[model samples]
Target chain A: MDLSAINPTLLLASLMVAATPLLLAAIGELVVERAGVLNLGVEGMMITGAICGFAIAVNTGSPILGLVAAALGGAVLSLLFAALTQYALANQVASGLALTLFGLGLSALIGQGYQGIKPPSFPKADIPLLSDIPFLGGVLFRHDFVVYLAIALTAVVWWVLKYSRIGLVLRAVGENHDAAHALGYKVVRIRVAAICFGGACAGLGGAYISLIRVPQWTEGMTAGIGWIALALVVFASWKPWRAMLGAYLFGGITVLQLNLQAAGVAIPVEYLAMSPYLITIIVLVIMSADKSRAPAALGRSFHASQ
Target chain B: MKLSKLLATAAVALGMATGAMAEDKTKVGFVFVGPIGDGGWTYEHNKGRLAVEQEFGDKVETVFVESVPEGPDAERVMTQMALEGADLIFTTSFGYMDPTINVAAKFPNVKFEHATGYKRADNVSTYSARFYEGRAIQGHIAGKMTKSNIVGYIGSYPIPEVIRGINSAFSHARKANPDVQFKIVWAYTWFDPAKEAEAAKVLIEQGADIILQHTDSTAPQAAAQEAGNVYTFGQASDMAEYGPKPRISSIIDDWAPYYIARTRAVMDGTWTSTDTWDGIGPGMVGIGEISSEVPADVKAEALALKDAIAKGEYHPFTGPLNKQDGSAWLAAGETADDGTLLGMNFYVEGIEGTIPQ
Candidate 1:
């Protein structure tokens, strides 16, 4: 292996940038799973956000506004899932799958006109003093704002989930919906709000990809990142900080594997190509004991006895 | 029920009217593996479809469905097209091999053409361009132009076709610049922009000054453009929009002439099941404009090599070549046969890494 082909600083920097999308999506999915909901529609909502964000950014010429539109579009799409499950009392699994299929088709239709068009470039946020530190500067200080925002959001989510009363109520609702409804919590309403929040986060993640990462619009551009994010939530034991850790770990492997291939590593290329997914699942399986750590009422729909 | 019957009768009447007006014309159908605007492989095929329409004028009606996944879904699409009265159908992807054969079995009267695949039946014929011939020219230019001696190749898959391309590129590159090294990254996808761009960046970070891709997409070219001074060559189609600098040249798949000829054969009822593999000389493959950004001497040399390959005076896989293990693959002055080239799986000498079975 060529040793000089690998660099610690650049590796760490790309690790953070690569993890941002997964982190954003995982954290949102974590919140949804914690609230006793499993929205497979994360893929659908993410792709909808991708195209909507791309079209708006290209038309309005503002990446910020494009992100906002992406969130709005995602929330609106997820709202479809939320309504079908909460009000109409449909099968959660089927509704989530339908949401994904619908989102894919709708996004393709909307993205038809925006294909092959490049959007405005996103600039990295250079923090003043910290950016000057030799090794740390290159690793932490030279990334787009979304990278920092994703980290900050992780911290905020961790705190809110651990210490806030809202967190307690959410946990209570998720553990036993009927018990919470008996005590006064509104099950459907809280779950709906949580789904919207998850949708918004997933949308931002998709927008980050379209507006800054690849910085162009193409159909099905999310490319199953949403599905990976869904897995990260379970691997994170439904915890936000744990999910962030998982995202970084998977991102690290992704970057490392590319480096290995570029360095002409003698390993089989097929194994190197699949290392990201294989390694992520293997590591996460070891980190999480599995099943026992998930929310008690996860994926179970709740209805009060009227 | 009454409205449905009326609608059905009107549709039949419309079909009858069109059939009577163009009774001698042919109905052709195209199945694409990606969007028509992908700016790469699928785009070139779609252009050929349009060319068929133009060549036949009112004598032919063409229909196409894009972004069709390979496998069972492809079979269903082919069946639907055959049912819709398509006289000839072109399935343009290697993965569509079995599906085309399966569909062609049920529709005994419909003609099927599969690209880049070897499978064939009485109704199904196999055809592919000699893309390696074009890659040799690209490898020559890349080898001469690179300052770091590391030419990055983004491969879509480890199949025989892709393997052939990588081998051809490396062969000519080492011939032009003995110090040249190849760094290959397989994206495992035919057209994913993000993954392609990411591969380009990694290659650049590893000190590659010239980028070559077997995958379809303009992302690598865009990535090269973003990284100033880095060079790239377009794949499958002429992506001149990124021209004059980053895209110094391209390997264009000229399928129009082939498509027109096949359609004409169908009209004349002379079409029979056969395998056709033609390259630059047959106009099925073309080396796009070598932009002025390339040094004049290098451009002329690349064009000369292209001419030699096209004129059959030289073969890209000529011997004096050894396998990656230094095993003698071909004796000096020996050329590879179609069977060996069609199933090429090993890297030529000087390239590193296993094929990753």
Candidate 2:
């Protein structure tokens, strides 16, 4: 029942770490969805990335290389979805579902020899002057590279989607693929690229769990975070900044509940455990009311001939 | 007409080939709650399965489905194993209690053993290691070693088995260090590495220098290692890789001998519903080697406590204990009966939080 034992500084820092994976994955899906393409294979790509990053990191003793390998592995896997849904004109929903199943099985195969082996240490980066700044420094400035990278990528995504010409073209392709095709924009090519980006982000997120968060490879260790990231995209209403907010809120509640339990809070444990999902959905649902909506061509396959 | 005659002959040959193999080999099926590579609970159970195979050689065939969820999916898996002519099946995890009972009834010929569960049927046996005995030793070591006097426990669920471990660990820890405070967080999952690691880290943040986990994963060990000077005990398996420092010791579940015995029982046609709960005494629960990280005197005392529990010279749950609400649970010098321990739902005195119902 000692409430003071729970350190607020550590809590905030942990919230960011916990949310990074979801944020990384959600930001990627936001772009894919913004392009009016729904790739449901995020969970699959994430797990494949987890093992890929873990295997490479353990072999090379470099967390950076592991992160790169993870992104590559995830993008490579997403190419399969791109080929099936784009060129083959297969159903995006079914293809995404199949991708998840394939990814889970595939990761298990790759992770066979990597089990129980720890990945190389990913040191925390303390931003020199910023990290020395009292309360904020401890809460915000001290974290691994991936935590900062996730936030930076979110900002980058927001800027790109809101201001860049490429973002406009991607969004136009998403809104009306047929019209975009008529405008001479290669709709399938935009979507394929978006899907690859989404895959790479999801991979980085997965590797975060393997190389930094849990720091070990266990089968299915991504454990539905990819699916949570998918839910986060809708929660964010396809906005990158909102995705970051939603991820932090979700991660904050998750860490907070565990903290509450340790602090001997009287709330029922079941309710506390479910609070993260409940609070995030409620807050995001409230925030995303009138102005936001899904892409017009979302989940639709574009065939230029049609 | 010639093709039809040839197909019939081929079908008969195929059927006979499978039937002959089935008759010669006794199939054993295992339904695990987590992946076999979890490096903890399921890992040990899977080791027991492998031991059964090694013991019987060509006479036994083992099949396992890992990471099976604890509800209807478990029933489906057990039913599939039974329907596929498995002579014996082991449903590991407490959540599979009812499912094991239900599946056993439908396949009376298939002997079933459920771990860490209470329910039993004529064809279903229940077997569990007395992990609390090992927990007592861990508690002694954790209590002796903690400079912060705060011991963090990561529990998988609020089940009786887990509750029993908490009570045992807490009581012994309290005996060694009266200032020791237990902070328990229920992860509510049997195996989620990320969640387990987070739980461990949160506890460490709250000043828990010694981390004890009831969940099955090595993630906590890694978390403790990162947070240097923190101590952790391996659960269900010897997480020896992190030894001599963070993982100062471990509680290992040795189910190999029991699995081999049960498989032999089924083979000998002497199988019946029985409850087997063995502690360090029977070697079902083992105390992993105490690493040099522990002071020599403290290590000796911990080993002594383990021996006393193993040789029946002492009972971890001896009386003079009170419930969390200050109600008398055991009178002075009175030991707990197996019945009460099996359905333990309350925390002993000095524990701060209530068990999540």
lDDT string, candidate 2, A37-116, tens digits: 89999999999999999999999999999999999999999999999999999999999999998999899899888876
Candidate 2, residue A1: CA error in Å?
A: 2.4
Best by lDDT: 2
Please, what are the lDDT tens digits per residue for candidate 1 over residues A1-306?
Answer: 795887878878977877888889888888888889999988888889888888898999888889899989999999999999999889988999999889878988998767567687777799999999999999999898999999999998888888999988888888889889999999999999989989988998888877777666766667778899998898778878778888998877777778888887888877877888887888777878755487888888888864
Error of 2 at B356 (Å): 1.2
DockQ of the candidate models in sequence: 0.42, 0.69
Would you give me the overall lDDT of model 2?
0.93
**Could you list the chain B TM-scores for each candidate?**
0.95, 0.95
Candidate 2, which segments miss by more than 4 Å at Cα? B1-20
Alpha-carbon local distance difference test for all models:
0.88, 0.93
Q: B226-338 in candidate 2: lDDT tens per residue?
A: 88989999899999988877899999999999999999998888888899999999999999999998999999999889889989999999999999999998999999999
